[model samples]
Target: MKDAQKPDHVSLNTLIMRLREGQFVIPDFQREFEWKPWDIKELMRSIFLDYYIGSLLLWKGKQENFNALSCERIYGYPKGNGNPVHIVLDGQQRLTAMYYAFLAPDVNLPNRANRALYFVHVDKFMAEEYDDAFNYDWLTRRWSKIIDNPEVQYEQHIFPLAIMGAGGWELPNWVQGYEQFWKNRTQEAEEAGDADAIEMAAKSTENAHLFGEHLKGITEQYQVAYIELDQDLAVDKVCDIFTQINSKGIRLDAFDLINALLKPKGLQLKHMWRAAASRLEFVETEKMNVYILQVMSILRQSYCSPKYLYFLLPGQEKPVRDPDGTRRKEVLITDAQDFEGRWHNAVDALQAAIKLLQHPHEFAAISSKYLPYVSILPVFASIQAHIKTIQASQRLDAQRKARHWYWASVFTNRYSGSVESTSARDFMDMKAWLQDDNAEPPLITEFKTRFKTLEFRKETKRGTSVYNGLFNLLVLMGARDWMSGNVTLADDLDDHHIVPKKWGAEHLQGKVIDTILNRTPLSAETNRHVISDRLPNQYLPDLIAENGEAAVRSILESHCISPAALAILLRDPFTAEDFEEFIAERQRTFQEAIETLLVKERLDLPVQLRELDEQIEQIELGLRKVIVAVLQADSQYELPSHILRNVKERIQRAAKKNAALDGDYYDTLEGKMEFCDLRELHDAIKTKALWPQFQPRFVNKETLNIKFGQLAELRNAIRHSRSADEITRKEGEAAILWFAKVLK
Candidate 1:
C-alpha cells in the first residue's frame, strides 16, 4: 500500500479543543496507564505559558462506508457530540495533559507567575483562601471578591496590564502606575460611553499579557509531525508506521499500539487483564507482566505472543455491520458475551492450574512455554466447556476435549521447535490425527505397534538405565518377588555393580569394559554404603538375608553366570552382553512401574501426573539441603579442624552433584552416592528432631530403638550395605517427606 499523506501543523488550542470532542480513544492494547497528575499539570503549564506543545495526528477511516476520524479527548469529554474528530498518533502526553487540566477542579499555581495571573480578587491570595474565591464567577462583572472591594490595596497583589505592556517595567513602580492607569481607563470608557475603552479597561485589569505570552510559547516551539492516514490503512500498518518513526529515542511497546486499536471495540482487554491481575494480587503488576503474557499465551493459543492480537483486527475504524446486508467477519470482541464467558472460563482453569502447581509433583513435566499457556485459562475453559467431564478417561474419548488437552500440552511443552516449521506442523497433524473420529482405530493400532517395539532394556555406560527395562522386569518377576528378592531391587533400589569397580591400578591392569551383568540393583541406603567402600563381601550377607536363596540364585543365573560360577563372577572381567542383558531387564521393570506407580499414587491422569513429578523433586531437594546443613553442624563436634573441613567439602561436593542431576535420581545409584556425603548423613540424623510432629516418637538410645543416635548408625549401615534390603512404599514416602520437611 502507498504511504498515507501527512497533515499540516495545527495550533495547540485547536488540537486541545478537537481532542475534547472525543476525537480519539486509547486502545486496550496500548501501553499501560502511566500518566501521573504532575505530568498533566506540566503540559497545561506549557500551554498556559504559550509554549507550542504540538499538533494531533488524525486518521481518516471508514466503518461500513461511514466516514470516521481517529482522535482523543485531550480534555476529558466534550460538552456536545462525543465523536472524536482528531485522532492523536503523536503528542498524546501533551494533549492528555491539556485535556485533564481543564477538567481538574484544583489548578496548581505557578510560583513565579503567581502575581501575574492575579486578575481575580486580592483576597484569593490571602491566608486560607476558599476554593470559591479562585474560581471565575461569571455572573459578577469582575471577580466576586475583587468587585466587592476594588480599592482594598488591589495594586499590591494585582499585576496591572499597562505596566506589563511597557518593557523593562519595575514590579513595585509598575504596580502603582498600572493601578492609576486602570482607574483612568475605566472612567474614560464609562463617561465617553466608548466600548473600546471599556474593553481595554477589562482586558488590562485581567492581565491578558500573562495568558497571551503562555499561549504564544506553546504555539511557537512545540512541533508535532501529524500524519493523517487514508481509510485503507490497517491498524497493524499504523502500528508498524508508529514503531518505525518512534524507533529513535523514545519508542512505544508493541502492545501499546495494539491496545489503542483494540480499546474502542469494547473488547475490555484491560478489564480482562485487571481481573487476571486481581487473581495474582500476591505479585505486583510490574512483576506480573510475565503472568499477563502467560494469560495472553493461553487466550491466543495459535499465537503465543499478545502482540499478534493487533494483527488479528487491523483497522482504525471499529468493526461494525455492513449496510448492504452483506455478511461481516467477527473478531474476538464482536461477541462480548461469549468472549467474557470464555475469559472467565480461562480464569477458572488458571485457578485450578495454580492449585495443581501447589503440588509441584503434578507439574514437573510442564515446560515454561506450557506454563504460560496454562496461565491463559481461556483455551482450557473453551475445551472444558465442550466436555462432559474433565476426568482423564472421559477426555480421552472427547475429541474436542482431547484436542484442547493435547494443544495445552503442546503449547506448554513449547514443542522444542518452531511453530512455523514443518516439524511442528507434523506434530500438530499427528496430534490432530490422534484426536480424529475416523482415525481413532488406526491411531490406537499405531500406538500398540510402537509400544510393542519399544525397547524395555537399553544399556548405557555411567548413567541410569531407561524405565522400559525396569518395567519389563517388574512384570516378569511379579510384584511380590520383585519387592522381596535377594539384593532387594525394589521401591528404592539403586542400580549397582555385581563386581565392584574402582578407579585404581588394579582395574587399569585389566581391559576396561562396560557390561550390564556387572551391574546389580541395590536400595539407596545400601548403594550409599557400598559407594564409599567398593567391596562385594561387606554387602553379601545383607543381600542373601533380604532376597533368600531363590532370589539370589535367579540373579546369579541371569547376571553372574558368564564367568565360570557365581564365586568367580566378581574376579573376571565383565562382557558387553552381560551388561546389555542386565540393563534390558532393568529397563523392562522401570516401564511397568512408571504407569503402575502413577496409578498407585492417584496421579495416573495426564495433568495430575505431570504435577506429581515437580512436587516430588521439590520435596527431595528440600530434604537434601536439610541433611547437608545438619551434617555441616555435626562436623563441628570433636573432629579435628582439617578432618571437619574435609567432611564439609565432601558434603558440599555431593550436594552440588545432586543439583546437576536435576532431581532425576529417585531410586538410583547416583542418588545413593549423593546421600553418602557426610552432610547428607548428618541431615538424616537430625531429620527426626527437625520434624518432631511427623516423628513424634522418641527413640530410647539405650535400647537402640528408633533413637536419633541409633538411627544415625542405621543410616551408616544402610549406606555401607553391599546388598541392600528392599525399600517399602511407606519407607520411600517417609524419606521423601522427611527431606521436604527439612527443606521447609
Candidate 2:
C-alpha cells in the first residue's frame, strides 16, 4: 500500500482552529490523562518565546483493523467511518491540552481567560519616553500612561482586550506605553482646541500604527510544524518520528508503546483484575501493588514485561492484515476470548492453591530457590483442571489434587531443572499424565510413589531433612504465599529440645548434641524463659507456665513418659531412652499429621463441590426473592402488575419447594419434633454454603458448639427484624465470620 500522506505544514492559527472544531477525537487507550497546571504554563511560555512548537505524527488504519505497530504502539483506537487516522503520536499531550482548553468549558485553566497567553513585565522594555509614560499593573489587569505634568493626575490605561481586536497581535510593553503617550497628547490638544491638537492626532495615529506594525512583525516571525497523517499510515512509523524529534533525546522503548496500543480493549479485564487485587490488599496491606502486578504478569504469561502486562493482555492483541489484500483486517474475537478465559482459569486455580500454603507451621519450612516457579499460578490452574477431569469427585478433589500437583510440578520444573520451559511442554505433559486414565503411571499416583524416594531423610544441625522435603513440596503445591517473608528457622526461633540440649555427660553416652529428633517447634520467646535444664520440682510447673496446662497434659498423655523415665531424666538429665522414645513419638505424630492433612485435603472433594453448588443455588434463590419482593409491592407504588405477578408466582413456587428451608434437614421417624425451631434458616444456608468439602477429620465438639452459638445469634438478628440498619449489621458480622472460617 502507498504510505498515507502527511498533513501540509500549517500555521498555529490554522492548527488551533481545526482543533476547536470536532473533527478529532483522542483514542480511549491513550495514556492516563496527565498534565499539571505548570506544565501547561511552561508550554505556553515556550510557544510565546519560540513562536512554534513542533509537528504531530498520525496513522491511518481502518478503525477495527488490528495491526502491530513497530514494537511501539501508541494507543487503541475505535473503528471509524473511513480508515482510522491515529496520531502517529507527537503532540499528544500538547494537542490534548489544547483540545481540552478550547472545548471543555469547565476545565480549570489558570488565569481564567486565554490560558495560552502569558504576561511580560514593563520592566523588560526601557526607553526614555516609554519609561516615564507607561504603567503596567498585572495583578489589577490594567495598563496605564501618566501625564507629564506632576500637578495634574490624568490616567490613560489600555486594556489587553481593547488593544488586541479580532485580528490582533501582541505588542511589547514599551510600544504600548508610547502609543498611550501620543494618545494623551492628542486628547490634551483636542480639549484645548489649539493647533497642537491637530498636530498631536496625526502623531498619535502614526505611533498607534507603528505599534500595531511591530506586533504583526513578531506574530509573522513565529512558526510551528503541523504534520497530518493519512488514514492508512502505521503507528510504528509515527513513534519512530517521535523518538527522533523528542527534545529529551531519549528514545521510547518499543515494547512499552506496543503495550500501550493494546490498552483500550483490555480495560474491562484490567478492572476485573484490579478489583481482585484490591481484595488481596484488603487481606494484607503491605506492598500489594507489586504482588498484584507480579501475580497478574505470571498468570498472563507475560511476566517478563511486568510493567506492561496490564496493557498487553493476550486478549488485547490485534490480528494482522493479509498482504495479499484478499481479506480485510479484523479482530480475532474468539481467540481473544479463549485466551482471557484460560488466563482467568489459571488465576482461580492459583488462588485456591495459596489457601493451603498459608498455614504458618507447614509453609515455614519451604525453600526459596523454587519459590518463583511454585508461585506461578497458571501452572496450578492447568493441573487442577486436569485432575478434576480425571477424578470422579472432581470438585472435592480439585483443591487437594491441585495442591499436590502444584508441589509436584514445582519440584520437577524448578528443583530438577528438567521441567521448566517457556514452551510449557513439560508442564503440559505432566498435566496430561494426571488427566489420562489408562496411562501406566498416573501422574498423582506416580507422584505419591516418588515422593517417598524424593523425601529428605538426612538430619542436619539446622533441623530435620523433612524441612527440606517440605520446602520442595511447597513449591510443587503452588504456594506463592509462602514465597514472601523470611522463614522462622528452628534455631532462630524457640524450638524446644524435647530431650534437653544440655544432657548430663553420663546420660548422653558421649553422643553429639544437635540431634534432629531431640528438637520440636516452639515459640522463641517462651523457650528462653522456660530454661534448658529444669530442676525436678520446677520441670512440670515450667512446662505448664509456658505452653499452658492443657498442652502439658496432652504432651504427657501422648508420650506416656513413665515415672521411672522422669526419675532417670532427673538423675542423669539426658538419658538416651527418654530422648529416643520422645523423638520417635514426635516424628511419627508429625509425619502422620502431614500425611493425614494431605489425604484429608484431597478426600474432602465431595463436600466442597456440594457447598459450591449450594452457594450458586442460594445466590439464584436470593435474587429470585428480591424480584418477588419488588413485584409484591402495591401497584400504587409504581410497579407493573404483570411483572409483579410473574415474580410472585416464581417466588411462591420456590417457597413451596423448600427454598426457604435454608438447607437444614431434621429427622422425625415417629410423631415427635426432632429439631429446635431457632430461626436458624439463614445461618444454615450460609453454613451449608461455606462448609469445606474436606472435613479436618478431627472435630472438637466443644469448638463446634461455640460456633453454633455464634450462628444462633446471627440467625436471631435476621429472623427478628429486617430493618435496614439491623440487616446491614448482621450481614457485616456474618461476612466477617465467614471470611474468618475460610482463612482458618
Q: How much is the lDDT of residue 308 in candidate 2? A: 29
- Segments of candidate 1 deviating more than 4 angstroms: 1-308, 311-327, 334-344, 351-414, 420-578, 588-744
TM-score of 2: 0.31
Model 1: per-residue Cα lDDT over 188-269, one tens digit each: 8889999888886765555433333433444343333355667577777766665665575343333334344345556656
What is the C-alpha lDDT profile of model 2 across 1-744, one tens digit per residue? 753444334454544445443334444334544765556445544543332344555554444423443222221112332222343355677765544432332223444433322222222221124323322222222212221221122122222321222232323443555566667777777788888676956555564654455344334534444445565544565455555656566433322232333344453444545655633321233323333333344444423232223233443333233667342333322344654565455455545544434443433333222132433433443444455556575443234444555444433333333222331543444544445522212334434434444322234344223444443333223222111123344344333454555653446654333444444343454345454565333565655576675655544432333334344434444445655554455445434433433422321223333243234334334423432333244332222334334434533443343433222232111101112122222222224322231124214434544444554444333332222355444554564355345333
List ranges where model 2 is wrong by over 4 Å.
Answer: 1-349, 359-378, 381-393, 406-436, 439-519, 524-571, 575-744
lDDT score, residue 156, model 2? 27
The numbered model that scores best in TM-score is 2
TM-score on alpha carbons, each prediction: 0.29, 0.31
